[model samples]
Target: MSERETWASRAGFILAAVGSAVGLGNIWQFPFKTAQFGGASFLIVYLVAALGIGLPAILAEFIIGRKANLNTIDAFEKLGHKNWRIVGALGLFTGFWILSYYSVVGGWVLRYLGGSVTGAYFGAPAEYFGQISAGMDALVLHAVFMALVVGIVAAGIEDGIEKATKLMVPSIVVILGALAVFAFTLPGASAGYAYFLSPDFDALAANFTDIVPFAVGQAFFSLSIGMGAMITYASYIDGDQSLFGDGITIVFLNSFVGVLAGLVVLPLLFAQGIDPNTSGAGAVFISVAGAFGSLPAGQLIGVVFFGVVLIAALSSAISLLEVVVSWVIDNYDVSRPQVAVTLGGIIFLLGVPSAIDTAWLGWFDTLAYKFFLPVGVLGILIFVAWVYGAPAIDELMKGSGLGDGVGITWLWLARTLVIVAVVVTLALGLQTLFLGANPAIIPPL
Candidate 1:
């Protein structure tokens, strides 16, 4: 057997994967999606999809990754067929596309982190975002954010990247938690919580067809499914621990972070008399900035809040970078530094359009969640459900503390409901992106 690298600690592996799973998807996309759908109605669907849809896909990826003990590319090849290798390669491709767009946004978070301190967005959230979100400013910030990720990768996985995630993940949780507590003390916080928790079920039922697909896509993309991020992260697992259990923990943490973010953000918005349910990707930025401007200690809290968001985003971006980095290291046996530089150069060039064109940001985000993500996840489900078949279940269940007899239950879902549902959802979701409800705008990185 070839020597394989594993995480030095289980906590490190779990945190790294969780960090990947929790990101702007949670802090940025989740709330906008919830508002757009049925508010409370959408939230219910999101939770179910996270458990039913997201968890199974995660376990499938972990099984393939751990069983083959290879990065996405080599993992599928080791599965025996030349055809299987493409499955892994597809994952890497999605991962690459995701980073091209995602890093650009991570840069926005980097800029906002400093802005929060400098009171750059103090009185005019709209104007501040308008000035900073697109054009040359966005491009520069994207470059800075990409550089941070590339630098960590260049320094090697253990010393530079993983260690940073271990710290960043905890800070994310602590800061988000603190922010939430602070929010509760705000004047209208209780109202904010009510608005978040209470759903307009009638509205949801009416819009269920259109809304369901988005919720499913949210569950899939928010958890980083089908991008090979989980598969890549699982490649580092050594303990014959129940992948089911670990997967559950990671998913729970990811979902909790999203809810926690809503808790912190919505209450503050409500207290500042901003509606919690607003439209557009810019809604939170607009609302949050206003809240920061009004509060007595808004600047300090804004710094901490945006800081947590930045940490969350950066940690997740590391996971995306690692996916490409690990694949290069595995296939070419190239030094980590070379892999980082090579991939970083490619991503930097690719991300230019995303940073410069704000419309491309929405398009890419839609394309990833609505089209590429579900399509890729369906492929993974097919491989595990039919190609790998019963053996995959046995292997996945072994020594997993998380799911015991649940193995049979999960395999059944993967074979039957999981793929079928994802395919249908992907179709409708893509339709919505290309045909319905999309606005033409320059993408803001």
Candidate 2:
């Protein structure tokens, strides 16, 4: 086999990693959850979870990938015990599972973007969403989105993934920033700002227990933890750049973009005097898009917003496809382009049911977000805490530049605190999924 590929530059790797994290979760889901769970309160808990649990978990994956200098499955096989390879395999599966439905949503974003330009859904957002969500149109759109993803991955890492992210990430930020400024200029925009920035202390106090799990789950999902994206991305690190700093940078960028997204969404909704208590699926389609129909230059604004979604969605989809492709190249003799086409084809086929059936799409989203993701996270935590043992600490200290004492601090937290929290989150997720009880607590996207 040829030599393993490495990132062309540290900035490219960071941008690609940040792009993976700042996806639909940041733009579509985070704002909804914040609107649902007392905005500032959810923000506070989410920040804690991101820095406390999410960052450590991300660093652990980085340690594993860089220390072993291998792809996901072999990274585990090479670094830890034999059976631990399943953790990596599970991550690969999680990436495949998520991208299946994720591409469907990407297709939806494209449809919405086109609709914005043509005023197709201008006066009838709900009907348009329902009509396009299924049938042959949805299938065709899904395939088109998957092809875009495959085309990027097939070009190889430096030329493809890194270059694409370098463009997309900056564009996403600039567009969202401009939209937020424009959104605030709308009448009654202060109400939205107040709703997002001001905390409901009493509501937060009452719902503290229920909110923690959602916050942690969102953090995990936003950072692309528990899945192989970080592990696979980290394996391409070319030099002794600090993983600790890069991990922190990635987390901060993800959280900032999520907050920036909220600034755009909440203001737009409040400007139309729409109640923010709608279901997540309807928040963007019914509330935001419906509001857009009534405003001046709404079509132009809608085009920009949905365009942002398209860029964000494609950025994330590339990472998901790369995860599976990286593993194939590591273990098999297949070329990158062939693997991209083959796996992308299967993933596109898998998404057909989701495109045809809304219920299937919902179920897949729940299954991956609630069950598979947390389980994958738990496996990594276990591997880092117990199996990897002393070598894990050694790996952490190298790039971190933190002494043994700080490494132990991280180790103990991961072994005890994070593990217990993940277990509880997993159990609550299962409970909510099986019983129809906890509808208020949203899972991470």
Candidate 3:
């Protein structure tokens, strides 16, 4: 058997991890979610859930991966009960399911990027989106996006993921910061700032029950936990690194980027006299595009904005693809390149319906978000708090400079607070899916 790969450097691992966390959700979804749920008040609760529940859950996954030093399924199987492997399997499938639809969206971003350069969508953004959103062009773009991801993964870990992320992550930050700076220069920018920063205590109190679930889900989704991506990334780290510090850094960077994106998007929308409330899945091609088209420099700004999104999407897509590819290579005798091609092809095929049919795209998205994500996260919490038991603490404490007390407290929280939060996420997800009320209030396209 071949020797397992390791990250080239701590910075490389951190960048890769951060890249995985910051995706399309951060750019459009997070800001929209915060605005919908009372802005600053929602932000507070989200921070709590992210630090308390999301961070610890990521630590748990890191522990399992680093301690066992194996692929997702093998890590759980080796460290916990035999059946615990099923958790990894579920996570792998969830990642796969998400990436299938996610890639289709990535393709949409790519198309918009092209249209921005050509000024094709500038005339009638809605009609332009309708034309390209479905049919053969969308599928070809999806294939192109998948090809980028597959090519990167096939190059081996350190040489591909690490190198690509080291470049992509920093670029995303600079571009987003530039956009935000430009956004602030717009007239009426203060209104966007007020909407995002001002707290509404009464609104928060009244909507706590309804808002908490979505907050929890956002935290989970933002961190790329509940799926095998974090576990797979952690598996590549060397023993000397601090998972706790790295985990915190990842969360902080991801959160900062999400908020920064809001600063860019919200102000741009407000300046154009558009209601951000109407922005959903098509926030870029619709809301932001509407604003850009009216600007003298719309074509240039469009390139920068969509380019940042494309990089962010690709970074996250690579991690999701890696989870499945790692599993295949771990269980089979095939080479990494071969597995990347096969699995990439399969994922592309799975996403075909999404590219061709808007309803099918929505359904795939709903299924993954509602069921796969929450359930898979819940399973990880159970495995860490129960099956792994004392060893989980040992894994978390390594190089963390922390004592057993902190570790024990984390375990207790995971077994209690985190579990409760995840349960709420799962329940609300189900209710929204079947009841059609969507109390969790997810964003639309």
Candidate 3 at residue 5, lDDT? 89
- Candidate 3 per-residue lDDT over residues 1-445, each given as its tens digit: 4678899899999999999999877885687777667777777887887888889899988988888778888887777577889999998998898888889989999999999999988888888888877889989999999999999999999999999999999999999999999999999888888877787889889887657766777777778998799999999888657888999999999889988988998788788887776534554567778889988999999999999999999889999999998888877788999899999999999999889976677677667767888899899999899777888888888898988898899899899988888888788778767775553234345
Q: State the weakest 10-residue window (summed lDDT) of model 2.
A: 436-445
- For residue 350, what is the lDDT in candidate 3? 95
Q: Which pairs of residues collide in candidate 3? A: 281-444, 281-445
User: Roughly what TM-score does model 3 have, to 2 decimal places?
Assistant: 0.95
Model 2 per-residue lDDT tens digits across residues 1-445: 5577888999999999999999987897788878777888888888888888888889888888888888778898787477899999999898898899889888888899999998888878889888998778889999999999999999999999999999999999999999999998999999999988888889889987557666777888788987799999999997778887888899999999999999999988999988876654436766778878988898998999999989998888999999999988987888999999999999999898888876677677767767888898899989988778778787777756777897888889999998888898888777767675545244323
lDDT value, residue 303 of candidate 3: 95
| Model 3: residues with Cα > 4 Å off, grouped in runs | 35-38, 205-210, 438-445
What TM-score does candidate 1 reach? Answer: 0.95
lDDT of each: 0.82, 0.86, 0.85
Q: Which tens-of-lDDT digit does each residue in 297-330 have in candidate 1?
A: 8889888877877887777777888888888778
lDDT of 2 at 93: 91
Q: If scored against the real structure, what TM-score would every candidate get?
A: 0.95, 0.95, 0.95
- Model 2 spans with C-alpha error above 4 angstroms: 205-210, 438-445
Clash count, one per candidate: 9, 0, 2
